[model samples]
Target: MTIITRFAPSPNGSLHLGHALSAIVAHDRAKADGGRFLLRIEDIDGGRSRPELAAEFRADLAWLGLEWEEVRAQSTRIAHYDAAAEELKAQGLLYPCDCTRAQILAADPVIGPEGPIYPGTCREKHIDPHNCDGPVAWRLDVAQANRKTGPLIWEDELAGPQTARPEMLGDVVLLRKDPDTPASYHLAATLDDAADGINMVTRGMDLFSATHVHRLLQALLGLPVPRWHHHSLLLDEQGRKLAKRRHSPSLADRRLAGEDGRALAAALRAGQLPTGISCSK
Candidate 1:
């Protein structure tokens, strides 16, 4: 099988140090194996997705010495997501969720990397009556999902030989059922990976919870599941993971302060990957 890797990023902001490392890993690995590196602008957030931001992403990537053979921005694939949803609904794998965010949040913690793990309140009903009125979200029926618990197994480039379960993930959203909107990140990314033949996915350890949903989607779609690697996150002095919110000083801003390519590249070299894994930055 040909090795294909992708560097997918949402263009809500400029590329940061963490993002730079992820792209370098994807591009270098593909180049090393004589494969292809793909660029995916995960600009599904219609409100936040902007043409200028997209262009800046490309420029920053070029500056970092990372490049791709092809680029695909998710905003243009709304119809594709709709088509994928139809397939899931036909397979009895999807359901309309009338549960508003407020109602779902009222129940208890949803334990997630970002929020409480969903309690799956509408599992039995299959329809959230409280807001069955309109403006629903599409969800995958995890209660009746193929197995009781998914100890999903896959080889990781960074965090190698791992297993994950649903209780740690909960039922994820597939489509934002408004019909006026598009699919969520989990939904769009799995389909894109399959469509682009991206058999390798590399991202931060912060997104480890998302891989379970991605694998389940692959199984449901009969698509080849990609090898996943959740690399360790670069942290700030406080030891908190770097992010746009907490880590205000981005590489973009730092570059504008006269930081050159060599200096920036050196800092990226010091960034860590999941324990036991190392790569030339």
Candidate 2:
């Protein structure tokens, strides 16, 4: 099978160095394997997603000396996500949740890899999907889902084999409360990968734990499984991960400053990061 990889980035902010590393890794990996590279705009957050930012993302990638066989925007695929949610709901694997972040924290939820694992407040209520009144998030009945799937396993290029443990995330939201935008990250990403024929899911290590949940979703949805490459994350001098919210320097900034993008891409390939940036395994 031809190796296919994608760099899926949310267009809520500018593309920073961390984003650069991830895009380069995915792009070069496809090239080295004689495969195809794709670019996906994860603009599902209607409230925060900006069309201008998506256009900027494309220019940033081109400036980084990267090319893609195709591009996918999540905004165009809401119907598919709703269909998947309906299927899961039919199987009794999804439940309505109205709990807010503060409520979950008040319960003193166990802190998981993603922080503050949901306390299953609504899961205990057994809210009837049909009776759910106004704006309520749909959550996966992870414990039940796990029981249905039995033991599951997925492989990471770096971490080898991993057992599926969706419970660690508790009952994660599959659909948000907002009717205009319902699909959650876990649901959309899994469906998108399968739809795009992505056989190699190359991304940063930060999402390594998410693969477990994705594996379970694939089993439940009867989607084809893909191998993953969880590469190292780019961090700042203080060892914190580079983030757009933190005002990390962006690729667009570098481009406007007359820096050679190809040279920077070459340097990144050689593990030569910009000043105060380091890689964490």
- Number of the top TM-score candidate: 2
**In terms of TM-score, how similar is model 1 to the real structure?**
0.86
Which ranges of candidate 1 are over 4 A from the true structure? 126-131, 148-152, 177-181, 270-281
For residues 1-281, write the lDDT of model 2, one tens digit per residue. 78899999998899998899899989988889899999988988868878898888888899988989656699889999999999999999998888888898999989999899998888879776566666789999999999999999999888898899888888889999886567888999999999999999998888888888999999999999999999999999999999989999999999989999999999988999888889896
Clashes of each: 5, 0
Off by over 4 Å in 2: 128-133
Task: Residues 100-189, candidate 1: write the lDDT tens digits.
Answer: 777777887645775766677665576753556677677788655646334556667766776655445677778885543488888898
Tell me the whole-model lDDT of each prediction, alpha carbons only: 0.72, 0.90
Superposed on all Cα atoms, the candidates' RMSDs to the truth, in angstroms, are 4.2, 1.3
Residue pairs whose backbone atoms clash in candidate 2: none
